[model samples]
Target chain A: MNKIQDIQQFLQDENLDAALITTPDNVFYVSGFKSEPHERLLGVMVFKEAEPFVICPLMEVPDLKASGWNFEAVGHQDTEDAWEVLAAAARKRNVSLEKIAIEKSHLTVERMERMEELFEGVTISRIDEKLNSLRNIKSEDELIKLRKAAELADYAIEVGCKEIAEGKTELEILMAIEFEMKGKGAEKMSFDTMVLSGPKTASPHGKPGSRKIQKGDFILFDLGVVYEGYCSDITRTVAFGEPSEKQREIYETVRKAEQAAIDLVRPGVKARELDKVARDVITEAGYGEYFTHRLGHGLGISVHEFPSITGTNDLELQEGMVFTIEPGIYNPEITGVRIEDDVVVTADGVEVLTKFPKELKIIEA
Target chain B: MNKIQDIQQFLQDENLDAALITTPDNVFYVSGFKSEPHERLLGVMVFKEAEPFVICPLMEVPDLKASGWNFEAVGHQDTEDAWEVLAAAARKRNVSLEKIAIEKSHLTVERMERMEELFEGVTISRIDEKLNSLRNIKSEDELIKLRKAAELADYAIEVGCKEIAEGKTELEILMAIEFEMKGKGAEKMSFDTMVLSGPKTASPHGKPGSRKIQKGDFILFDLGVVYEGYCSDITRTVAFGEPSEKQREIYETVRKAEQAAIDLVRPGVKARELDKVARDVITEAGYGEYFTHRLGHGLGISVHEFPSITGTNDLELQEGMVFTIEPGIYNPEITGVRIEDDVVVTADGVEVLTKFPKELKIIEA
Candidate 1:
């Protein structure tokens, strides 16, 4: 994946003097270094001709070097502004600081102002689209990491299914799932692990609470895992005890919709096509309004990335693109059901990374 | 806490036409609603006179209402730009967009540009300082939530201590601690749960890995919990077995430094004073160079908030202000030891919210 080369080519083709890549995800993508700087600054500065350099908190220098980034890494003390360091470092390359590009959507107003103040008269433009386009297609190495993440996510769902029992609180099951995941060498959950049960499941983004799982409760486990630097997201809803007719109907409808979306994932297929296919499946089952929100989002370094699967996005699916196909029916009066699978677009068709069964699993408590 | 009224008063005093609060912490501080908007926009538009309005994704409108935001909550679909919805909602207030204020430190350059494009000739100024000042002091209810969060964090450390074993990997101990926290009803960790053991403990901000803890090694548990909206951060390092002379010296130095800083916490004392007191202690121990980074940061809605406990910050301590007092001595050639505590400035002295003992514990595991 000619990452730095791709960014350098973008700079040269656009006639921009340089590009300042902020945002931890983009920084990691460019430099192969991972550091959650939080309030501190971490940037990857690429040039039209000069070698790229990194500017980060002084403490993270060793980490950057360990990450295989051999380029100059300028370290700033806590008291110093990182932009000043960046400007000084960029000047060291003897390049004119004019017409620079940046991650406009990520660089804060405060930081941007600081950058402007440091680099006098520099015209900045957005490089977000270029970076997003470059990161959209995953490489074979990234796929390997994603596949491992998906395996752990599937195991989390399996643990959630096993831990579901009568009188067990939603968080109790969540704890068991996360505990097992960490023990299995998962770095961390891609996002907050969700385990919702009974009526709580109807809340589209429900927080696991002390509400105990009762008989006939439908337990929904939506969780993911981060393996290395890649992420995988999976959602699986299981029925505890025998489910009611309405619950069974909702579960089957979401399963069909999710499968419909998964089936349309291939090269040249528009992202919107998958959304339309899934939406139609849910709409035909008379739960169109219940199936709210978009069908899916691209998944890789971040659990949610680019090329959103919605009815309006016209982006064509490309091979090596990994994403989640999650379609849910949240009906408070009836029941909530969602089926999710992490899939990677393939040259032929698709490879579903998440192997967790989509069929209804009614666990006997 | 008279939060909204305080914001309105600030707007009136500053002669601001309106304020666009975008950061989730500030939004939740002003209004009761909380959301992780991810890439989508979540903003609270407050005026000097007009009722505050919230703009969020259509899917989160219900959650916003449930969170007790009774005023207008303009919900935007996934396809719609939330900034457009926010602009329309502000226009409906019939107030001049001129002389608006924004959280410049949190708002992205892209969003700031969008605002300028939408509201032509709008003069925007930073309200970040005002917001931070307003949130500096905690109320009775806020303190209650913080205390609960601290209690949970202490319990987490207790769990970690019990789970420590000779052959256990760092991740195994971390899993046990997090599992206990989740079962005890922590919303989530304020940050990633950190459990570093042996040589890994020397790496400040090290990720818990499969590194096994042998006999003579230091185990550091640095984690926090988010209770309701408040956050608590605590770091405690313990010896798995009999420590070396250097390890003991480092531990004692950091503990003394942390205690010295905590002892200096009172009304009217400068934030820098505490940092100096801690820094001085470590310096006198001949480990001045080893102790890097700031002493701590203000803790409340956000784990790392305003009034960063740095030697350079001149913020004055006041009653009801909550923050962490952490001091560490990280010498890669030797070992690392850190001790942290959550403390609240009281009328007379400081109330240590984190009750975990600071005394070094030598666990014969």
Candidate 2:
């Protein structure tokens, strides 16, 4: 994918010996292999001059080979200490271990200490910013997977809307949506499929429970799908039956806020400007205190990635930058309403990947 | 729960001022509150003398309070720096930040540097070992939850078996099993549900895909359930129809090895002994090298936890210690067969929590 070579070039430019990319997403990004090495070590060690090598669990070596990585691939046994194996692999390169760049945001303190103990006063710098920026701009191939993922998410929302019934629990609807997603070939969800309902929706991060849906309840489905290697997140809140005036107002305010943010997505536009436009929409509606979280986040290989769309982040929206535009108002006394859409910035303007309707739908169950 | 008080007492005994529990599992363990803060921050700061506090994203403050945590629970907005909020909370305790304990295994180097920057030259000790020891022995209440989780896992396996048929994809069977698990009130799977078929089973960590199941194929179902807060993992591989002689031999050898390990679990026995016994059985059967991974891992609130059951670990199993005793043989030339069960070390011997038939089942469809 030329990503490893790019890292090597980055190391040369920064005058670093090497860079250790270990986070599963970054590993997949650097090498064309995807694996979730839970607890086990998985890394792609890229040297400025030497050829890059991928180190993973011994069993995944064959899988890595099948993934088309022509570079050297090393694996460690379950009984062996993976860190020492990783160190030995690096030593074979014959590069002086003086300065190295690691993902300081992902590498644990324990692992960093082990690396230091192995390499001796190796001045460790961060590879986070460089990696984040490189990953921010999506390639054409990534956009294809992302667009497919968005289509699946839109279908999931449709299925979820159809599954809403009189006495069905939140879990039942959630199970139906995920089961349908699996049938449609979504290997996994970007995150846990949240199917929060009623007052439970007031908490932005509420879990799907056995709470039965009833009349006058606002059901919130904040979910995403991972297709190929890309991710798409979309949230749609619909009313079960007839809703109160307060519910409609909250829904309208959130829709306006979300739309405003998406409209401001264009090349050369500061990411924070979009956030302010969305925040201003919700604030002018007198729901400012209720809108608690950030506007949105970047989406790609990782559902939540670089260029956080927050009021504080001043990152400019360059062409090919894909992200989410979500804004919500959560008032426990009334109801919580959130509308989100996956968007990609283009040279001229923005393209909203998720096609789910933003208008509040009153589902007559 | 007196867990917070226990941590405070440990702090006094260890001559440390405070301990920062940032890992989501540890956060849920110390405070009765559970949360996954993603990129945001969530922690439990337990001081020796001052009152402990739970810090989370501002949006989750109400949810934290609802979890019945009476102690002070602080929240930070997305716009505000979470690390600074965490430091300010510690400062409010009025305790000298001379020495502090942190989960070095979970806290990232970036966060550790931030913490060190906040508390100038503070001696940072590790709370990993102490926390691991505390969580190793399950309480009676925890056992109840584990038992329920194990039952759900057994049910999931039964569902998976029933759904396996000719022309059925591995993901189809996995979807059905997970759908039924949700129907039975299982909030989540301990890990990603694995249903590997035929040659795919040869990879111990194979992912379920669109590959159709055929006759003479070894179908592996490695899954778990999370009930309440406890987790249970179980793996069972059955033949789709009449298997080949080699498949039967591998299956029986794995079964025998698993049984031998399960029989060896008891108080005073080293964790490595079980791994060795299982390894010896497979080695005697002439497929020792095929059993690539470790025997299993300790299980509780977290699916994979302390005291990994490997050939090198010498940790002694004590009463109320719960873990998985899984042994498998994955030969890509033939097929993979794994037999797993959740067992707890009792005062006298062991009690297998997962009640599922381990006999080689030939599913004729």
Candidate 3:
């Protein structure tokens, strides 16, 4: 069944009168229209009995229809009240507006209050969990796009590694990587393209700056690209020159942990167990305290999606599930190393989508 | 007084016990620490009678401190409950949490419900309007950064114009413009860079694709850059070659409307009046219906900020208020033309931050 039909089925099974899907991602998932409306209202109202319709900025109506969204679209101009338009559309549908389910995780309190006022005495229910569960399993078409996106991400890392040299600033290297990616038809980066060198890499979420690369310093490249709406994220840390024993050890530890976590990724394995497998490898090498973050997160439409792979999550791995396995060890006084790869869980094993090598490559500078 | 003090005073004046700021822009505005937590909890709790503190991801504590946030930062790991950490921090402050104001426009329903459970029976009030009012006026330092950002944006448009030629795809031109901007030290674009040509320009929010430019086609360039945490947005439409009479007429109409709107940017002028000044010009040119969107929006730390300039808003323009004056006329069958300028309302008149020329330029192809 199509995604919209699946959502309608969910509403019927859950006994929801209708569902108010907010957030650009959910809206795009339900309808084939994607828009970054900023503060403007953009939503899809799906009913179990009635047809689904989209309410968005009037300027976006044509584009929404052009995106293959065949449902009715209620457009509101800047001068008009968007809520009134949404309410009118709901009234026109003649469906039960009571007991409407909303994406509570994405809808703001202000919008929620407005929605309540629009539909007085309506019982609002949270559908965030249901939506996440629905989005977790990847379809074949989604996987195809995801695999292509992964290929682009791997190519980005390759270009970044080749651009590395002594005296080149991290910002310059990042620019080269993104420029090449754009040239190769990347719609945009999944997230900020991070390229941190030396001690700057110690910060797990460090921004690329004007810090120049030095001999023997480790440079970390964590970036992703969006292709056909799906996303791919990968991280690889390489040495600019012959590394010290400490740098090499840290790099090797992270590589082993990442590989072990990937090896454990199969159907029926708990997410917590995968995280533990990686953490144990780093802990055995005496870098337990340095491994600060979670193992990885689910990756698809957004870089960080549902089902986080952390030490506490008990979500079992399932076939068709796609996520990342990134293990890192960071010590500000020494070095930081992270190796990430996108993976898809198969019936019995896992298919690694990102093909970039994780072995520490010492580039002559 | 600093921004934090301003919020504390607002809390006291409003008889609220404290304020919880959750939006990233508001957090950065209040604490000088900016972070994109990506679903992770990051907020600042400002008390009326006690010291303020920040609750953020553990990995961001050091960076928060480095941003000159001297307050106590309560950090939580992925395995820990961030709300519990926040509760502890609030308890340590010993401030009354009975009545707290929150950014209702930004805090999601899920987070609001969690906060409600954490502070059982707490009286939650909306402070979104107050926050918008506080951030509406640009400080001198902020204006300085905004001016620099505007300069960078103008430079980007210049680079984009130079890269434009017949047979060059819109995506290629956009890539060239962004690559040049990055090389010139731009941290990031304020919004997605739009380079639409010919019929594609009719969609005001069109994304740049692989459509190559052709002779007599109008190319729209709407882009901005972020510098020193401030944002600048500018839009200009240029002709690829000698344009038809219709294209030239539409281009001149937009230019006239933009100039009329910018000329009306002064202290004591109503926002609605300024919008009318532009709308009147387009309406007189027989393209009123074609001009679909609002005249413009406020621009600062975030590109699209508060005090939207529309035909309905009656808020009076004031000194230190920075906004945009963009006017466009789009016809799908023919072409589209838009001229935009970032302006700061001065005590007497206005200061145009974006200095790129608005006159239609006919580039040889």
Candidate 4:
């Protein structure tokens, strides 16, 4: 009832009758069920100024019995066409297919064509941005999971920092950290655990390899953890020896910039403007071009989500939205330093969730 | 040049003038460049009896330089604006838009509509099945990597089986095996390591959890190793004690069925017919309904690929086709047993790539 009401409010404000969600993340957002990737099913949550109904495959009815949802179950055999089941659900709900809005971002050509053929007179419009907007604001349950995910990442890096040393390959370090995370009950890594040392750290998304870690190398570990279907991302850099004056200065500048970006994250602030706050600082420090990728991205069900923290986006920050504040300076031949933290937007300020020490640490081999 | 000729011959046989490929796997198959997912970039490999041209983002050019391919590379930033790039390539090739075929299976709706808009006169017939046919066969280079992947999986599981015990949790076993695989230089896992024990093994793809191992429980470990983008899959079941008579009976039935399925695979045989070899064996044993999913799927760049080993698919097995022959039986409340192996169809017979010991092993906890 609570999720249905939330959808009703979202539809009323977004001016949509019903949303045909095909993305598992969006479906999980609306319905409580978390399906495996190969489920090959679509979940439709419709709002028509009343309680919403979840239309799913008939085999999933037994799984959803405890969800306390209203009944509109349609179980069909594999040989039975899915269109017939969907059409029957539409007729039962008295939903005018002409007003149905579908997520253009996730809908495939095959599925869209099948839907068009099933409801011959239906009007299907793109409602992708509206669904993204609904997901932008994190709920209480989401924040709880996000915070735990951040804690897991923090603990993982703590293990990685202790295990990283000279003669250890980047691949070895990555495996060790992943081992520690899985030991602590992480479902899986949010993404590939990036362990780049020295010159290899210059690339934003470098793959971990057998390149041996050596003394005087600047080690950068960018990793994340997936916990309870939510994701947390964090990156930290350390010097394997006494840092050069240049490395020290660059690390301090990036630390200040990352904290500055996090400080600007509050309700009613423009996301792009906050990006510029950190960007301008690095630009003044003469490392502007080196910071090539976006400042951050909204994270939840997927690793990267909408409202990119880039100069091109004009979306406003709102309370309950959680994102990352990662700022870096990469020089291909010399060194790379990146510091990242997960932050949740609050009414007055921001809450930093990750607690891994980011201050440039000097580790001796 | 050889791949280009192969596609040209395929296009000529199909009576198609040109074909547009947008799927990343298809692109990688043709161009040898693996791209990032969910990006605005498109890797279009076109064929018309000449060297293939690759249309991709501007940033990938540096990486492509090392491949030594004969492709004419065109780079573009805007996806909508990239149609002109494709059009210019087509115009340069002296091929008009008509009679063009596209990979319909992988094309997104947004890109499909754009292609239609720019090349209004072209007939974009679905060339999906043809592309899958080409990808089904593996090249010598691909087989070398697959063999290495299989060797890594074999060694890792051998190490894993030694560590299984009564007090170990499923998650612990998965991590232990994954760590051992990483130690052996696997870039990543082909899929999530499924380590299910006791009744939990009934679910084909059960998530590893905190459930501790117990005496006389069926321990199923389904895992794969990814080495240099090639995948290898293997599954083995172990009983913590002397398995019950019924358990041994089920295990033997699955082993026989899996071996029979492997024996049936060869050039010129239909994949579905091979699936029936296993299905019939399990069905005749009175455990037919418990084998819920497909027998197997093609294994290559992606863990699960084309030419699904299901009764409905009519694709014929080719000499270089590599796939899994996994036959399983799940008793809802009792236990489950699955024995899977990677098989490569040869000219005269099939070669099993997965060398992991499949016999039911009784181990003391």
lDDT of each: 0.89, 0.91, 0.90, 0.80
Q: Taking the tens digit of each residue's C-alpha lDDT, what string does model 2 give over B121-144?
A: 899999998899989998888899
Candidate 1 wrongly placed segments (more than 4 Å): A165-168, A212-215, A242-246, A362-364, B165-169, B211-218, B239-250, B331-335, B362-365
Error of 3 at A57 (Å): 2.9
Score candidate 4 by TM-score against the native. 0.90
Off by over 4 Å in 2: A162-168, A196-203, A211-219, A238-253, A283-290, A329-336, A357-365, B1-14, B68-70, B161-169, B197-202, B210-218, B238-251, B286-289, B331-335, B360-364
Give the DockQ (C-alpha) for candidate 4.
0.38
Output the better candidate (1/4) by DockQ. Answer: 1
The digit string of per-residue lDDT tens for model 3 on B50-70 reads 989989999789989999998
Native-referenced Cα lDDT, model 3: 0.90
Candidate 1: tens digits of C-alpha lDDT, residues B134-171: 88999889999999999999999999999988888887
Error at A143, model 4, angstroms = 2.6
**Cα lDDT for residue A341, candidate 4:** 90
TM-score pick, better of 1 and 2? 1
Name the lDDT value of residue A234 in candidate 1.
92
Give the least accurate 10-residue stretch of model 4 chain A, judged by summed lDDT. Answer: A68-77
lDDT of 4: 0.80
What's the CA RMSD of model 3 in angstroms? 2.9
lDDT of 1 by residue, A190-229 (tens): 8888999988888877888888999888898999988898
The residue-level lDDT of candidate 3 at B270 comes to 97
Better of 3 and 4 by TM-score: 3
TM-score of chain A of each: 0.97, 0.95, 0.97, 0.92
Better of 1 and 2 by lDDT: 2
Which lDDT value does model 2 have at B360? 90
DockQ for all candidate structures vs. native: 0.61, 0.57, 0.56, 0.38
Ranking by TM-score: 1, 3, 2, 4
